[model samples]
Each structure stands twice: as structure tokens, then as C-alpha cells.
Target: MSWTDGPFMGFDTETTGVNTATDRIVTAACVEWRNGQTRERTWLADPGIPIPKQAQDVHGISTEYAKENGRPLDEVVIEVAKVLETCAHAQVPVVIYNACFDLPLLNNHLVRLGQPTLGERVDFLPVIDPLVLDRALDRYRKGKRTLGALADFYQVRGEDNLHDALVDVRQTIAVLRAICTAYPQLGEMDLRQLQEYQRGQHRQWAEHFNQFLLSKGRSADVNEEWLV
Candidate 1:
């Protein structure tokens, strides 16, 4: 049996900006599911940088607010890393909506702060990306692809907002279930195999999206920073 036979965790984070190398984490959440039960943990950190108004507008985290109410960045990062490391050792897949962004952004924070980088060990563990799966399976689908949009498409309710970390994690789990239901063919595979399958699908989906952009005379920026 694969790791999917046991427990799993869903993770999400809201940051100060799009640059993984420079942006700071404002909020992060993780939801763990096992034996039909779910538990969630969230953290708000004082990023020690000015949260630009544009970024704050999206995630609703202000510099003043975080500095006054949030925990220290080092403390929050350590706690999150410890939990992630423990889960990784247990063979639990961390289901992130967008692994390319969150995973690297997290590692960057840890490395900059002289803390242990979760990516060093956690990279070997399984990671499931529902966003990639959604685009891969529905390559031709139109309109938005944000979490809220995907939630609406799958008829998964209770997730209209995007800022609150814990709420977003709960909604992410719901969206994952909806995706599994919508794409039954891919849902039957074990965790590791499923991850491998999605990577190929992601490549095809990226090409399709790029082609669509080209037809409109617009060039797609391939950099990950443009993802947000």
C-alpha cells in the first residue's frame, strides 16, 4: 500500500509578494486528514517587511496588523517545518494547491533565516497539486482558475474568500475531493504514481495554455514569479 493509504495533509500560504526569493510569508495553513477526520493549523507571521498595499489587498494582511498581532517569523517557520518534517517521515503526502510556488517560497524563507530547509528532506515525500490536475484534465475549460473559481466549477461550497489561511486549507481539501470525483480515471492511482502522472499532464497543459496566449499575440512569461 502507498502512503495515500494512511494520512494526508493539505497546505496553503499567503505571502507578501510573488518573488519566492524575496517575498515573505504572511500567513500559512496546513490541514491533516486521517481516518475520515481532519485537523488544521494556521500561523500568521510578522514578516518584518512592509506588506505592499496591492498584496495586502489580496490577502488582507497589513504590515501594521501583522507586526502588532502576528508571531515572529522564525518561530512560525520552525513550527511549520517541524510538523512538515514529521509528516514527511510518516509518508504523508502534503497536498498543496500550487507546489511550485509555496514549496520553494517556504524553502527560501528557511534558508534566508538560517533555519533548516524543509525542502532538503521533504522533497522526497509526495506532493499533490490539485491546480495542476485541474488544468491538465480540463485543458480547454475557460474563465478563471483561482481556488475560488475551481471550487465553484466543482460545486464545492464554503470557499468564496481567499485570505484566511485555515479557511483556505479546508476549502482546498474540498476542492481536491471535487477534482478526484471529476477525474475518476486519475483518482484511482496510488499517491506516488498519481504525482508522476500529473507531471506529464502539466507539461501538456502548459503547452496548450501557451499556445492560447500566442494566438492572441501575447507572450506567456514562463517564470514562476508570474504565477501569482
Candidate 2:
């Protein structure tokens, strides 16, 4: 069977800010799809820091509310890591919209909490990132490539509740399935080949984008790593 037909897990995070290295996770969700069934798990964390107004505006999780209603940050991070590790051990692909940002951020959180990092726990392989796949497959598609835009472009359901971790995870899975339908070649690839393809594609795109930035007299800041 195609890897696309096998068990896969979708992951997403809503954070306190855009600085993945420093920002804390305010919310996270994982949706596991297998054998035509789906199981979802979600977390809301205190983050142990103030959730900036701008970030709260995007996700509607205010600092005050999170402090009152959320679980401990360490507990949330540990549980999320365990879930991802479980999927990794089971050889399930984790479908993340942008693996680069979320995975590193979660790893940072694990370090901060004095826990084993994801790489140490399990081989961080066979990750399926719809964002990288779409950019590589479509190449020159104009306009925004945000999750909401992809949902609209792919005609996936559940576009209304974006920025919520669980909703975004669901939308990401739908977008990935839509992408596979549009590009059957992806379904033909084994998980390792697909992951390597994305690594190369993301590197090429980053180099091109960096060159564009340098041409426009801006700093070339795009990361070339697929899952850093």
C-alpha cells in the first residue's frame, strides 16, 4: 500500500510568538489517522510566560486564560513528545505543515524542561510536510501559502477555525491528502524517498529565496534545513 494509505499523524502548534527558538508553546495538537479512523489529542499550556497580545490575537489564547485554564508547560511538552515518539516508533509519518519550525521549537522546549530531545528518543525521519511539498510541486504558484490559503486552494473543509492547534492539524491533514490527489507521484514514493525529496526541494527553494532577498538588498535569512 502507498505510504499515504498507511497510518499518519498530523501535528501543529500555536505559540507565544514567532521566535521558535525562544517562544513558548501555548497550545499543540496531534491527530492520528489510521485504517480509516482518526484519534485526536490536544494540549493547552501555561508557557510560564506572558502570551503577547499579537499572538493571542492570532490564536485567542490569552495569557490570563492560559494561566488559569492550561496545564503545566513541562507536562504538556512531555506528553506531546511522547505522542510524537510513539508515532515515530510505530513508523507512522507525522504530517506537519512546516516541520522546520514546530519540531525545533518543541525540541527546544524539551531541552528547557530537562527532557530528552526528539532526535535522541527516536529517529526524526519520514516526516511529511505539506508546505514543503506544495512549494516544490507547484513551484510558481502565486499568492499566499498560509494554511488558510492552502485550504481554500485545495478546497479542504474546516477553514473557519484556523490558528487553533486542533483545527489547523485537521486542515493540514486534509491539505496533504488533497496534494497527494493532485500529485499522484507523491503517493508512489516510499516514506524515505518522500522525505528526501522534500529535503532537497526545501533546500533549493531556500537558496532561491535567499538569492532573491540579496538581490533586493535584504538579508538572506531563509534556513536551508528541512527540519532544523
Candidate 3:
């Protein structure tokens, strides 16, 4: 069956900040979407560090709350990696809103915990990123493309309570499904073809964005890969 037929794993993370390399994960979610139903698992990690006020405000996960209710970072990291790897090897396309951020963040945490990264467990697994796909498909659509915005624009049926990992993942899956329903061309390609296509598409956008930055007299260095 095609990946869109359902059983896609939608993954998302809420971290301390935008620096995936240094920021710690405060919460993570993996939601399996199949035929309009969902099976989800979530992780909340204490991170063993301060959660910036800005990050806490966005996700509503305060440092004190995390410390009180969350699990050890090492334990959560290992479990999340295990679930993601299982999904990948099971051929469930990992659906993400902005994969470039979340996947790398997960990997960085895994490394810090001395655990295998997701790639170490699964090889070239299929990834479906709605952010990359939307940019490639609707390059001229002028507006924010955040999870909440996309959820609204796509008319996805769900509460778009972004910043919370589980809510974001569920909404991300909804937007993806809506995209498939609206654009048959996207659904025509199999999972591997879709992944390969996004690689090129993401490079094109990165180059364009780089030029835009340079035009503003800023550094134009940006990773051009879609998948981390």
C-alpha cells in the first residue's frame, strides 16, 4: 500500500530553544496515523538543565514542572530512539512538520546519552516533511508556514495547539493528509520517490533563501538537505 494509505508515524519535539545542537528536549511525541485513527506515545524529559522562560512560555512546560513530572533525559532519549527506529524499519514514513529541526535535535540528545542515533538503526528511511513539501509545491504562497498556520491553511480538522509535541504531531499528520487529498500529484509518487524529490526541492529553496539573505547583506550559509 502507498504510504498515504495510512500508518505514517508523525514525530515532533519541543525543546529548550532553536539551537538543535545545544538545546535539550523537554518533550517529544510520536503519533501513528492510520485510517483516521491514531496511536501515540509521548515523552517528557527533565533535561537536567534550565528551560528558558521563552521556551517554557511557548510550550507551557516550565522547568519546575518538567523536573517534577518528567523522566530522566537518558531514559526518554533511548526510548524515543527505539520507537522512531522501529517505525522507520517498519516502513512507516516518518511524517514531520519541520524535520530539519526535530530530527537533529533527537539525534543530538541520543549522542549525549551514548545511544545509537535514529540513522544508526534504520537506513535511508522515508521521511515526509510538510514544510519542505509546501515550500516546494507552493513557493509563492505568501505567509507563515508554521504548524498552526499550515493547519489553518490546509483546513486540517484538528486543534492546532502547536509547541506541545503531541498536539503538534497530531496536527502535522492532519495537514499532511489534507495535502494529499488536495494534491493528487503528490500522492502519485511512492515513498522513496517522494523522499528523493524533496532532497532536490529543499536544495532549491535553501539556495533561494540563501540568496535572499545575501541580498540583505547577511551570511548565506544554510544546510540544503531536507532530512537531517
Candidate 4:
């Protein structure tokens, strides 16, 4: 596939909490950039549970508001998965900041509702994580490791608001482009090759990060295995 023949779908989600099995998705946003153009979409779902004050503060969607205004969780999840699966079939990578979190959370949501989970085939098609790429590219950099900070470091803009999934997805594209500019070698690689490169980079990042923590006299949490 041509590297630029996108339908590169970038995805992000806002949820009740970070626990994939327990928490539910409250909102999600996706951007489908196809053949150099883009279409954006967002979904807000009732989550079927109270959105805690702390979680609501992050994404600005409360439980009562969701109950009144949001669509059913199943409907939202199905559409989101379908949109992503379509893009993947077109040889597009669903660019996410942390696919490990968002993809699994979405799958768990489906499983919880007695629906089919988004299988590995639905997930592994050329996925990209700007967070892991940034960590890999700048392994020795100090300070914050957030999406916004990476945007700043790469000189990629439009990350003033992060909790909004749609907005974050656009910024993620900018971050990817910036990384390509910073590391010209990446521009030569096709989608599948790039995905493999990212997998290696993520593995190295986990090793390096864990080593840093250990050097600082801290024990790594087992729960953080996903990040590794």
C-alpha cells in the first residue's frame, strides 16, 4: 500500500476511569484522513454507569448529561469499531496515542455487553502510537511525557485541549508528521514496515524506562506491563 494512501484513522476516547474491565467509555472521537483529506466524528455514550466527578472533570461529560443526551453504549461501540475496521481494511493504521489502553477498553466494553470483542485482526493492522514513538525518538529527553508535551517538543500544534478525543486525534496526526520530519528515515518506510519499527521502538522504550525507574530506586508496578 502507498504510505500516503490514507484512510489513516486516528482514535481517542474519554472514559469513566482507566480500568479497562470496570470502567466504561463515555465518549470517543475519530478522524479519518483519506487520500490527503479528512472526515471527523465523535460519539458520546451513556456508559450505563455514573461518571465520577474526577473522570467527568477530565472530559467534561457528566453522568446525568450522558443519560440525558448520549446514545446507547452498544450502538456507539459498534459504529466506532466498524469505522476503524473499515479503515484498517483500506490499509490504514488507526493512529492512537496508546492503543493498548483504548483498543482493549473498547474490546472490554463490547465483551461486557455480550457483544463480540474487537479481535486482534481488527486491532493489529498498522497501529501507530505517537506516545511510544516520542519516547523512543527522544529516549534521553527530560521532563513531561504527555501528548501535549510531545506536541511542544516536536513543534506540532493544536494540542491545547487533550481530553477531547477528536481534537487529540488531529494533534496525533501532526505529531506523526513531525516525527517523520525529525527522523527522515521513517519517511522511506511503508506502513507495515513503520508498524514493525514502532513495535521495536516501544519494546526498547519499555526497557529503557524501566531501567530508569530502577536506577532511581523505584520498583516498577506489574500493572504497568501494558506500557511495556
Can you write out model 3's per-residue Cα lDDT over 119-226, one digit (the tens) per residue? Answer: 888786788998888888899999998888888898884745567899998888888888887777887898889988999999999999999999999999898867
Stretches of model 3 off by over 4 angstroms after superposition: none
lDDT of 1 by residue, 1-228 (tens): 434343779888898998989998899999998876998888999998999999999899899999999999888878888888988788787888877888788888889878878757555567778788888788788999888888888988692566677777878778887777666776468766876776777766767668878888999654423122
Per-residue lDDT tens digits for candidate 2, residues 1-228, read 899786889999999998988999999999998887899999999999999999989999999999999999999999999998988888899999988989999999999888999999986556999999999999999999998899999999683678899999989999999999899988888888887899999999999999999999999999988875
Clashing pairs in 3: none
> What is candidate 2's TM-score against the reference?
0.97
Provide C-alpha RMSD values for all models, in order: 2.9, 1.1, 1.3, 2.5
In order of appearance, the predictions have TM-scores of 0.88, 0.97, 0.96, 0.88
Candidates sorted on TM-score, descending: 2, 3, 4, 1
Q: Point out where model 1 deviates above 4 Å.
A: 1-6, 214-219, 223-228
The true-versus-predicted C-alpha distance at residue 169 of model 1, in Å, is 0.8
Worst 10 residues of 1 by lDDT: 219-228
Best by lDDT: 2
lDDT of each: 0.79, 0.91, 0.87, 0.80
lDDT of 4 by residue, 200-221 (tens): 7777766776787888999854
